[model samples]
Target: MAAVEIAPTVNPVTKAKKPSFQIEWASSSSEVKEAQRLRYKVFAEEMGANLSQNAEGLDIDEFDAYCDHLLIRDQDTLKVVGTYRVLPPHKAQEIGRLYSDAEFDLSRLDHLRPKLVELGRSCVHQDYRSGAVIMALWSGLAQYMQKNGYEIMLGCASIPMADGGHFAASLYNSLNSDQMAPTEFHAFPRLPLPLDKLNGGLEVDAPPLIKGYLKLGAKICSSPAWDPDFNTADLLTMLRLSDINPRYAKHFLGL
Candidate 1:
């Protein structure tokens, strides 16, 4: 297969000349469709998001049209290895819904100032799950956030599991609930799980992504909520840009 060719585009914010690995802001209709295609491959086909035909193997919704899409293309293969969607707080509030709202309540956050940004649909092709790909995606996001003056980053971090088993014990262990709970915590009672059938115990450490967020001083809000689409309960996490650990700031943003 011929490598997918991506033309280099200047970063609107920095204006610094850098040869990104086909990093571009998706603007055209075809680019959006391609993003949907990649989403289908990862979310529906690979992750089993239980989406209907309307989802078309694509994990998209009404918000996609209004949000900005970040795509990372493999230079040699020209394939989209990683992708994420960023929704500005203004747009999110106008839309009155977030990707996690289906799983958790978000109305309580209406009072927070400085606005917010919701990060979602974060997925990388299975074959290209590496530090470099993730780092590139974050680098692009950091630049975009810095340019826009975003104050906080919020999103749900999924804990992977085959069945409906939840894996947020470590998060509960790490951050606990009282110190920093989500303003809109889940009020519903915990769903039952067959603890005996699960592999070993479920109380393992946090996943890399969750740990990464915590290391960045992100606080876990409330308990886990069941996400049928992904077949895993997710814990909502929030990271204030000012609170991010200095170590990651240097490593990820080159500060």
Candidate 2:
């Protein structure tokens, strides 16, 4: 069978010549649609993931209506290089739940939900996956959290399971001891990854996004969940504002 040739992402971002990228909330529905299109390109076209709710090359979902869409756009090309959908507490209440609730049981986190924000559908254009672009995204997130007085953030960090889940299993086991959250905050996955059946000895570095969260003192609050549609193992990660690594917190929050 012939392999799918993924489209090359345009206009790569670099540290030396970083493009003028502006991060802001989506001001219009069109902007939100653009972010969704970028997501489809990466999560669907590039990775070959099956998106059941995807429509017209956009990763559409009910949560989108209730969430704030943050976009990082390249001023040179006027293209959206990165995006994150943030569900604030009130909006989560309006929607009656968060997107993460579908993949994992978050009942243990009810107490934190009042001051918590749920981050979902986070992605950066493949070409713009540089330190500058990602940092810009995080800087926006930090500002949003502080501006809104959010105490905690939660999201699912994904690891590709195309290797038949071995790497995901190994990565989970490797980080469990040091990065795992307390039992009181533990979540249960709806479709848990079968770790026992997979090899957990392979030494593989976590993906950059996951690693960044860990560097910021994010905790893995549950075992891996098998997301068949996305073909990845999802780890529930939580980060409290007070728990951020002091060294990097200033950089992200501009403190």
Stretches off by above 4 angstroms in model 1 are 1-20, 54-57, 169-203
lDDT of each: 0.68, 0.87
At residue 129, what lDDT does model 2 achieve?
A: 91
Tens digits of per-residue lDDT, candidate 1, 127-146, equal 87866677677767777788
TM-score of 1: 0.78
Q: Which candidate has the highest lDDT of all?
A: 2
Tens digits of per-residue lDDT for model 2, 1-255:
111111224555633443378777887899899999999999999988897654478988788999889888887788988999999999999989988898999899988999999998999999989877777788788888998899999999999888999999999988856699999999999999999999989999989999999999999999999999899999999999899999988877665
**Candidate RMSDs in order:** 6.6, 7.2
Q: Of the candidates shown, which would achieve the greatest TM-score relative to the real structure? A: 2
Q: Candidate 2 has which clashing residue pairs, if any?
A: none
Question: Can you list the residue pairs that collide in candidate 1?
Answer: 4-77, 4-78, 40-57, 182-221
